[model samples]
Target chain A: MALDKSLVSGSMTMLILKLISERDMYGYEMIDTLRQRSNHSFELKAGTLYPILHGLEEKGMVRSYDKEFAGKTRKYYSITSSGMAQLEERTKEWKEYSDAVRGVLALEVSVL
Target chain B: MMEEYIRILLEQIRCKKSHKYIESEIRSHIEDQIEENMSRGMDPETAERMAVNSMGDPVMTGTELDMIHRPQMNIKLIVMIAAISIIGVLIHSLMLHDSFLQPETEMISGHYLRDVIIGLCVMTGICFVDYSVIARFSKLIGGAIIALKILLIVKSLIEVNSAVKWIGYGGIWMSWLLFDMIYIPIFGAIVYKNSRQGRKGLIKSFMWMYIPVFLELLSANMTCALIMLISMTAQMYLAIRKGWFGESYKAAITALVSGDVATPSIAASVVKAFGSVFPTNTFNLYRDIVAGFIANDERNYITGMLRTINKAALLFGDSSSELSNSMPAADNQYMLTYINCHYGIMVGIAVCLLIGWSLFYMFRSLIKQNNQLGLIVGTGCLMIFILNLALNILINLGAFPIMECWIPFISAGGSCIVLSYALTGILLSIYRYKNVYPSDVDVKMPKLKLLLEQ
Candidate 1:
């Protein structure tokens, strides 16, 4: 099932940090990777992606710079150490919450 | 197509500091998106459209960007201006009660207080107005002021025996002095429009200034007229040196004096230009007025008055009461003399401090402005305050001819107070939008650059 935007939006910074931690990427690359990694289930619009990137940059959680890549100048964002730490904490919290939801769902299904 | 979209998006964004980086980033993002779509076998046009559409909405994105980048008010500048204005008004009220100058014709303090309130509201209103809007409609504004000034001059002419003063309906004296200052933004606009064309543009700007100078000369207010001429030239010099002529002022002057630059027929061309714009009868009248002003020997009258005022001031040591008793009524033209004599040297020093502080704040703000028009307008306002302060001081010290001029905010004229406040408001607006251009702008100030290095 597709995730609601409200659920996805709250984790935008975490998702962006997670993507950047793997490799330095620009806005379009990050959006594409997030969709492919989620099997086309999670799609962050350009409008949504850029603001989150900018917010992360502003908060010092990520840093961005312009560099030539593939014969074209692109602004690539990279995760900082702080961004990595936050990503780790967020990943752990997300795993516990999803596990709790799945346990409740399993109980309901067995009862049926 | 992507570039065009980005252009429109940026046009909606107000903050100039972030504009360049944002532009590059947006362009890079759009290209990457389009390329990704192209890899999926989409046509170039379709891929471009899809990339742009996926950006959500340009307006929404621009609004989001604008929130992060807005102009900031200089609080210190505002506080400094407020302090000076309050001090000016208090000193004005003190002048009214001193009772040494003359028996009061009307309660001027009440009128001044009312104008102060009105002026404050007007100032606030102008502060919110974008100065670009003022620049856009400058021609209409210039024309309207010219018409108003001409009408006032004519009205003053018809009311003989009260020949010098332009008295309004209730015998309240109208200040044609400050009215001329409204031309400053127009001067900035004209220079901005024509700064790059050639010597021809410079002459055209000078001709526009000459219109007011000629009119004020006819109205017999020579000091204000002279001040306008000097200030306009200063503004033009600043704009031109900033590279309007594509050369330095020294280079341009050298070219002119060496006969390398062709001289335009200033008088004939100006007259011809005026003829084309105005009807025949009005043109003839303007021609006669110009001819009469040109023919009159202003030097003799000015020197005569200067000698008389200087001799009297030197002998008496206090010209307000002593000079007025012996000679013709000194009137408010001798503001510095009146202040120094009636109030003591300390009060005079305080008044000077107030004026000096206000100018200092404005000068600092002027230096920080990034927009070209903001720089020009701020410079023009600085010239006005500087010239007024300097001239008032010289006239007070009997160092120069006594002429009718006001002490900026402290002067007890309604129109002067209101218009001076309004001018300050415009300066504040310039200060507010001062950084509406990128900090990386290469403004040419060769002399200043040299001084700073030393």
Candidate 2:
């Protein structure tokens, strides 16, 4: 099933920081990596990704530089130490949230 | 198809500085998507359409980016500047009212008010101007000012003792010496924005810095030359710290140390080269004149009088000894000492604190700037304020040699007052646009080559 639009939007910053934490990636690469990793279950819009990346950069959570790949100039984003800390925090919070939601749903199924 | 989409997106973003980078990044993303789609056996037209479709809602993205990059106003800085300008006017009025210091000529009474008014207006006007213009044309602007100074120097040589420093027309005069303070900010722009990358760029920036310093020395304005050297060197040190020239820290430090060590010899050589062309050894002549005054302290009228008044000054009220009517440039250069004698030592300290506080406030804000151009230009402005205030206060306290320095904002001199305001305005302009520019946005104006570089 496709993810809820609002759900993806709310956690977009964490997702972007998480991707960049693995390695420095350009804008298009991040979108493609996320889509394949999710087995095409998540497809991020380029328009959505860039604004969040730029915002994270402004907040010093990430830094960016331009690099040439295959003779094409691409603007690449990389996570800073602060971004790593943020990703860790957000990952912990997400795990707790999903676990609680699954627990409640299981309880409802048993009751029914 | 992608071009139209990108254009529409950029239209929604108000900050022109972010446009070029955003457009390129978005265009590349769409192109990458199109390549992937075509590899899946889709037709070129369909692949292009599909790629553009995936990047949702350009207006929304642009608006969100706009909100992040909008121009910011620094209200506290504006208020502080206004307070300082008001304090200047009030102090000048107080000086005018004092019977001992009141000038015999009518010209002296009205001049301070006129200068302050004009200054404040010029400052307000400058605040609205985008300071990026300085960065954009850093070479042209820096070249033009240096060219003007060289022209003035040539004129001075031809005319023989017809004041090279003052440029006057129709009863209005400006001291090129006072105006040279603007070069500090212009120098910052050239180093940060125009200079090429790495060691060659470093050498070129130093050359740009010394030309003015050399010109000032040639004209025998040691104080102006010294101020330019110290401030520009400080700026270069800052650029090194920022790694603008891509040099290792050790290499940068060595270059700075050697530059500082070499300056005095360079200055001495310039003085020696021009000594015969001029009537006297201008450098040593100034030194000897000042040394003679110090040796014969009782005969050195201004310093002797200031020393006596300072000794007699009370902590919170007027001193018993009156400041003599014959105090030279009493309204401008000696305004600080006059305040101590006429008002109180405490009041003079309060004025000093006001000026010091403004400097501290400005420095605090300046360091926080994310944009390189803003930081460089702002540092230049702050350097001028710090140097002028330190020299003026030291002279007032009889700790430094008395020269033609004026306390920024508070002194009653037309050129000094206006120049101080203009510098403050530039700082405010930098602060005003702080958020509007991203850290990596290229500010260099295109298609213009530096005349010197060619």
Q: Which predicted model would earn the best TM-score?
A: 2
Candidate 2 has a DockQ of: 0.48
lDDT of 2 by residue, A1-112 (tens): 6989998888888888988898999999999999988889789998888889878876768877666899998888878887899999999999999999999999999999
TM accuracy, model 2: 0.84
Clashes of 2: 0
> CA shift at B292, candidate 1, in angstroms?
21
Per-model B-chain TM-score: 0.68, 0.88
**Which runs of model 1 end up more than 4 angstroms from their true locations?**
A1-112, B1-68, B99-101, B104-110, B148-173, B196-200, B247-331, B436-454
- DockQ for all models: 0.17, 0.48
What proportion of the true contacts does each candidate reproduce?
0.39, 0.57
lDDT of 2 by residue, B1-454 (tens): 8888898899998988668777888999999999999999999999999999999998998898888767667788778878887877777776676666544322454588898889989888988888887677878878988898888877766666767678878998898865589889988988886434788888888788877887777777767877888888888888888778888878877977787667656766766677556543466655544573483654456676677777778887767544455455575678777778777899899998988998899898887666678888888888888888898887777777666677888877788888988998898888777666655557667663664566
| lDDT (tens digit, per residue) of candidate 1 on A18-108 | 8899899988888889989999888777877766776565445776655578898777787877779889999999899999999999999
